[model samples]
Target: MSAPEPVVVVGAGPVGLSAALAAHALGLRPLLLEARTRTAERPGSRAVFVHRATLDRLDAVRPGLGTEIAARGLVWDTRRTLWAGRQVHLRTYPADPATAPFTSLPQTVVEDLLRRACDEAGVRTLWGDPVREAVPSSEGVRLRTASGAVHGARHVIAADGARSAVREAVGIGLDGSTSATEFVVVDVADGERPARPERVFHYRHPAAGGRHVLLVPFQGGWRVDVQCRPGDDARHLAATAREWLPAVLPQVPGPEVTWSSVYRFQLRVAARFADATGRVLLTGEAAHLLPPFGARGMNSGVGDAVAAARAVRDDAVEAYARERRTAAERNVRAAGAALDHLLAPRPGLRLLQRSAAVAAPLWPRAGRWLDAAPYGPRIRKVRY
Candidate 1:
């Protein structure tokens, strides 16, 4: 295969965009393909947290993106845990001047910034032409778009989301299971929250009926997540938030709902992150799936993009697969452990949560580890 051959990037979401941008930085041509005519401008917020390491990855691939994105989003360090209407653990992320802080922004804003970066790089992106199928052979892989136009590439990066067509075409299988917890995500415009700017997670909220409610502030509003039973009505977010959030945060004057959704979180890992010949790779949700907790899904996906591109440039796709799978398994374990603490019917687990909340103030480090990744810090590169 020739180095000049374009690496076809399927999916134009953050993962795909990062992959394309990273490929360009690695001196490889990236031809991006998006099923949608335009980028997502959804009213709802999904995968909104951009961790410190992720900001560094973005800036490395595209100069000044990290600073620009941080400038446009809201950064918060302190996260408090509450139970029965009282503050328990006030966990704080200490200032690390060497690295970028964690940031929160709407999904639309993230996409818009990425789109601008793509334009700046002069990367080729084909919109309205979804990748329908990928035919791999000895020479290269041939991609058939939804419009039936065939494009040939030496390699393909599949960031087409969890339900990836390229993954199905290449015959990859996921190994994990979907969680039973159904989460109702509510995005409210200009919702009422504390003036200090922080994150609040409540367990057994009174109005929420023993379930958890995560309150996160965005650029101009707050995103409230209410844990509901599988059989609960998903459409009643307004009523549920009014009942639970008001009891928890008295400062909320009125929450105007912008968007809402109820989804069953899943803990899934692809059997492989790359093909046998190492010509195709999966990034972001295409490679793994985890609950939205800890903000690992999209952030980790961005990591996948950078790693995959570097692997392609280095001619070591297998290493990329191993390192990414390791990261996915790590994140999955953390998210699962946290979920277990949140929903484990055992009273002992409840006591643990409550204890951590109460003890966090005196022993701040106790609360710090409660809401952290089970493995370690975000894995940036694979060291052989």
Candidate 2:
């Protein structure tokens, strides 16, 4: 038998790790490449919420993987939305007890768990080596590292994130819009009073001049997101978060910020997930970007990686593009609605939002229409 063509995966993030694991499950050896010496050491949780569909996809790659993740992550079915200190909407996702509706795990932990899985599957990772040049040829994709070392692969999975060097080398482009409102995330710990373990969203805070604050519970602390005016400074964000975080997470007393991050989020997707030869592929933030409102960013990317690997193995990479594109469109729409609801500067929109929030609490039956960002419609599985 001829030597098996190598399958190379770029980036060691969750998407990259998942891609490698998926390929290994399909009887293919995968080489993972990462520019960084190690995973990010950021203090706050980057992406936490993992949806049911994502868990299902992960289980497909490795049997019982979803159960293990669910055991480590936070699983919830109810989220409460408050406007002006009044509980407006108490949305609940009633699902079968066997399958949790949603789960939340820190991005770093997720990556670490995936890396362990890769190790068990005998996948090799080259740390501190970034793929510099990617030349797509009929035979395969020829890649050159930043150190000038050359490697050849039958195909490539680009999971290098939004600032993907591999995507640039292969000339793949993404399109999306950035919201006008800026979001600052801060993870804080309060030993005196622990934060409530629930998804709490405060919209139209009186002290913040109707701005929004989102609070999600993590393992040891609460990850707080403060909506700020465009181009706000860090000092302003810090002070604002310190003053108003309690409005959303009232139980926390004397909160101490451990790590904070400021970023401009967008909703973007690549023109295509795969090249014409199906040799070059994109996954995770490399393929698309969506705000964290519905926990769509990293969660959706995991799905992309799993589907891409299966498609690549089955010689039907186009199916990955078609199925993922549909999901991206749906997620983009959900993100837009969430962003608008978060920052309803317009009088008419603000009134509509307030009415919906009230409707949810008053008539729980009306919540189906008041969902700011529902956990998306069911995505059809791509049969590769």
* TM-score of every candidate: 0.88, 0.88
CA RMSD of each candidate after superposition: 3.6, 3.4
lDDT of each residue in 310-337, candidate 2, tens digit only? 8878977788788888777777777766
Instruction: Report the C-alpha displacement of residue 141, candidate 1, in angstroms.
Output: 0.6
Q: Rate the local accuracy (lDDT) of all candidates.
A: 0.78, 0.75
User: For candidate 2, what is the TM-score?
Assistant: 0.88
lDDT digits (tens) for residues 19-72 of candidate 1: 999999998988999998884445577877787788889999998997778777
Question: How far out, in Å, is residue 202 in model 2?
Answer: 1.3
